[model samples]
Every structure is written in C-alpha cells, then in structure tokens.
Target: MAEVLRLHGVRKRYGGGASPVVEVLHGIDLTLAAGAFAALVGPSGSGKSTLLNLMGLLEAPSDGEIWLAGEPVHAAPDAARTALRNRYLGFVFQFHHLLPAFSAEENVLMPVLAGRGRLSADDRRRARALLERTGLAAHAHKRPVQLSGGQQQRVAIVRALMNRPRLVLADEPTGNLDTHTAQEVFALLRELNREEGTAFLIVTHDPGLAARCDGQIHLQDGRLIEPDGAGVVTAAATAPLTAQ
Candidate 1:
C-alpha cells in the first residue's frame, strides 16, 4: 500500500536561549499506510502531541524528513506547507471546536472557505453529502448549541472530511463522550475509513480502542516502542522511510 505519511529520524526540541535545550522526541520514525487505521498510545507527557503536530505539518521537525503523499515537506516554505496541509490533512480534537455562532453545515464548510476565501456550489454540495453520510442531514442547519454532544461531534467529523483529506489526525476524538456514545463515534470513524479509503492516526488512551486498530504505535519517553509479538515497526536502528 502507498504510504500516506512518513517520518524519518524526526526530532523536536524546545527551551533554547538562556535555558537548556530539551529534546522531546528522540530520532523517531513512523509511517501510516494508505487506508490504514492506527492508534497512537502513550502515557501523559510522552510527546504524543509534539509528534502529532509534526505529522500534521502544524510544526516542523527539529531534524529529519517528513513526507506527505510522497512529497518531502519538512523543509518546505511556510506558504507551501500551509497549502500542503490544507490539501492533504484533516484534524479532529476531543473538543468539537465548532463555532457556536455557525450552523452545522456552515461549520463543515469552514475549511473550504478558509482555504479558498469563498465556497463554490460544489463545496456546498459536498458539505451536504458528508452531513448526510454522518446521519446529520437534519441537523445541518442547527447551531452547535442545539445539538447533543454526539451530534456535535458527528458534525465535527463531517467538517474534517469536507476536503476529502488523505489522512485524518484525531486527538482524543471521543474523550469527552460517554462510553456508549464513544463507541458509536468510533464506529462511524471506522465506517468512514473503510468507505472512503482515508487513513486515520488516532491519539487515544483507551486500550480497547487502541487494540481495535489495524496497528498500535506505542510511545514511551518520546521514542517508539514495538508492542511485544506484534508485526509493527521496530524503531530502533531503522532506515529512513521511503514512499511505497
């Protein structure tokens, strides 16, 4: 399968100038295959957020290469990176982050508007289609305040899919939901992944949810650890990742 995302010897550091530099991620390497569903699991303060930021192109790696859709992007210009991010990535957080003032449909269209300055007829059509797919068609015109928590999250998920992103980065996507609702939302994500062929890298703390993924990436102290007896990547002394 083609790789949707790849990282090689990626590192991140902070606290320079006057303070000692702290390296958060240590020469990490990872790859997500197209249409694959994977969970990123680690304890708190394990650099999961930093790794996600690098993968999403929200921040550049302190060292090493990052490839998105086969393009090496770690050294790309800010404008170029921004364009690539809008073109190839989508993000969902624990909080829906929906604008309270906007209706569900409008929230879904936010990405398009932000990227293109205005929405076209096709954009509106796609938004409606995604809303329907997530069973939120009837709630499309309702504001976030009018929807239940699950409903609001469903809307957020639809918003993430508006651009048909190649990969979706979900950070604790169901963390705020009740157990039953979290399961339902997770099911929706799996259904969408299968139906749309979009790869997913979900940052989650739930062991059950992590185990359900095609693969689990474990992080300890900013390094990738291979799960015992699993056929996943062993980060130690690995070669630089190449597109496949």
Candidate 2:
C-alpha cells in the first residue's frame, strides 16, 4: 500500500512562560499506509485522543512534521489545511454530533454541505448508498433523538464517509454503546474499511475491539511505545515495525 500519512519528530506541549511547559507527545514518529485500519489503544491520559486530534488537524502540533497524502501538513496555511482535511480526512467522535434539527440524510450530507452547499444528485445518491451500507437507510428521515444509540452512531459513520476521505479519525466511537452494539459497529467499520480501502486511526479503550483492528498503537503519558508490540501490533502488519 502507498504511504498515506507520515509524522516525524512530532511533539506537542501545553503551557508556556516560566512554567513553560509540559509535553504530551514527545518527538514521536509514525506512518500509515493506504487502505490501512489501525487502532490507538491506551489508558486514560495516554494521549491517544490528543494524537488523533493532531492527525485530524483539529489541533496543530507544537512541533514536528505531518505529511498527508504526499504533502507536508504542519506548516500549511489554515485555509489550505482546512481544505485538505475536508477533501482527504473524516472524523467520528464518541458523540455523533449531528445537527439536532436535520434528518439523518441531511446529517450525513453535512460535510458536503459545509464545503459545497447543496448536495448534487450524485452526492445524494452517494449519501443514500452510505446510509444503506451502514444499515441506516430506513432511518434516513429520522433525527438523532429519534434513533437508537447504535443507529445514531451509524449515521455518524456514514456522515464521516460522505466525502470519500482517505483517512478517518475516530475517538471512542463505540464508547457509548453496549457490548453487542459496539461489536456490531466495529464489524461495520471493518467492512467499510476493507470495501473502501479507507485508513482509520481509532482511539479506543476496549482491548477486544482494538485486537480486531489491522494494527494497534499504544501510548503512555503521551509517548509512543512498542513494548512487545503490544501497541500498534497488527494481525496483517507485514512491514518491519519500528518505534521512534
């Protein structure tokens, strides 16, 4: 697979001044190839969410370089970064974060709406296809409050994929679901990842769910660790694994 993302010497710190500082990410380096599905598993305060945010461009890194697609991202202008994120990245949070007033179909079309105004006929068709893929076609007219937890999250997944992003960042997407529902959601995500060749970087706490991903990454106090390959280990991972 082609390399889709690369992070080198990445670092992030909070606070400045004489107190100047505590660092979370410490000169971390990582990469993701096209069509890869990986999980970020760590205990609370391990910095998984922070790392995911940095990858998603939701927050800028304090230092280091982030390459997306083939372009270096760390120094890109805000508009450029936003455009790139719109075109190539998708995000699913623990909360669906759907608009309360929009129907499921409308919610699914939000990213397109934000970037391109009204949905084209093709866009609508794609939205429907995604809804169907997530088993939410029947709920397209339903609002978030009208659907069950699983169904709402399914909509969120469909929304994330509406733009056909090459990379997806998910933070605790299944945190709110029951075990059975969470498994179902994970299965759906895996199917979509295989079918669409979309790379996923999910931050999850469930070991069982993390074990199902193609690769697993673990963090401790914001530093990346590969102890026993316990983190970022992959059932299908064939590349020489290294930690930096």
Candidate 3:
C-alpha cells in the first residue's frame, strides 16, 4: 500500500523565550499507509494532539519533516502548504464545527465550495451520496440546530470527505457522544474506511475504541513507544530516540 503520511524525526517545541523551550514531540518517526485505520493512544501530555496537528497541516513541526500524500511539507510556502492541506487532508474534532446557518448538505459541501469557489454538479451528487450513506439524506436541507449531536457529527464526517482526502485526522471524534452514539459514529468511520480506502489516524483515549482499530500507536511524554509485533504499546522507553 502507498504511504498516505510519513513523519521523519518530527519534533515540536513551543516558545524559545527566556524560559526553557517546552518540547512536545521528540523526533517522532511515523507512517500511515493507505486505508490504514489506526488509533493514537496516549496520556494527556503525550503529544498526541501536537502530532495530529502537524499531520493535519494545522501546525508546523519544530525540527523534522512531514510528507503527506508524497508531498514534502516542512519547507513549503504558506500558499502551497494550504493548498496541499486542503487537497490531501481531512479533519474531525470532538466538537462538531458545522456552520449553524447552513443546511446539512451545504455543510457537507463546505470544503468543496471553499476549494473550488463553487460546488460542481458532481460535487453536489457526492455530498448527497455521503449524506445518504450516513442516513442523513432526509435531513439534507435542515440546519445544524435541527439535528441532534450525533447527526451533527455525521454531517461533520461527510464534510471532511467532500474533497476526498487521502488521510483523515480525527481528534477525539467520539468524545462528546453517548456510548451508543459513539459506537455508531465509530462504526460509520470504519465503514467509510473500508468503502473509500482512506487512511485514518484517530486520537482516542478509549482503550476499547483503540483496540478495534487495525493498529495502535502508543505515546508517552511526547515519544512513541516501540511497538511489539502486534502493535501493542509496551513500556515507555527511557531513551530519547525514534524508531519505525
């Protein structure tokens, strides 16, 4: 399978002031292959969100390289990076950030509209198809306020796929939902992974949820723990190093 994302010695640090620099990720080496559904499991300060932000093009790494869909991004210009981010990456968050004023279908077409200035006929068709797949077809013209939390999240998921991104970065996507709703949303994401072959790197604290993925990446204190053959997280390594 083609690699959808790769990180080479990626590191993240904040504020090089009179105070000591606070580093979040330490020379992280990671890769996500096409269609791979993986969970990023870590404690609160383990740099999971920092790593996901880097991969999703929302933040730059302190001292490493990131390649998304084969495009090197560490040194790209802002415009180029933004273009690549829009074209190759999709994102979901714990809170559904749907536009309150827009209808469900309009919310789903947001990415397409933002990228192309307008939605094409094919784009509209694809949006409806995704809505249908998510069981939101009948609510296409309803605003976000008309939908429940789970339904809003379903709309958010469809919006992420509007541009057909190769990789989706989900940060606690199911965090705000009830158990049943979370399960349904997680199942929907997995279903899309199977049907569309899009790689997903989901940051989750739920061990049960992580176990259901194809593999799990474990992190502690901003470093990835070397996984055994089964991709299960072992003990936290003391060495400040990165390994494949």
Best by lDDT: 1
What value of lDDT does candidate 2 attain over all alpha carbons?
0.83
Which residue runs of candidate 1 sit more than 4 Å off their true CA positions?
Answer: 227-244
TM-scores for all predictions = 0.94, 0.91, 0.93
lDDT of 1 by residue, 89-174 (tens): 99999999999999999999999988999999999999999899889999999999999999999998988888999999999999
Per-model CA lDDT versus the true structure? 0.88, 0.83, 0.85
Q: Write the per-residue lDDT of candidate 2 for residues 42-85, one digit (tens) a residue.
A: 78987877788888887888888888998888888889889999
lDDT of 3 by residue, 152-230 (tens): 9999999998899998889999999999999999999999999988888888999999989888888888888864224
Clashing pairs in 2: 216-232, 217-232
Model 1: lDDT to the true structure: 0.88
**Cα error, candidate 2, residue 167 (Å):** 0.7
Candidate 3, TM-score vs. the true structure? 0.93
Q: Who is ahead in lDDT, 1 or 3?
A: 1
Return the lDDT, model 1, position 201: 86
Instruction: In model 3, state the lDDT of residue 190.
Output: 96
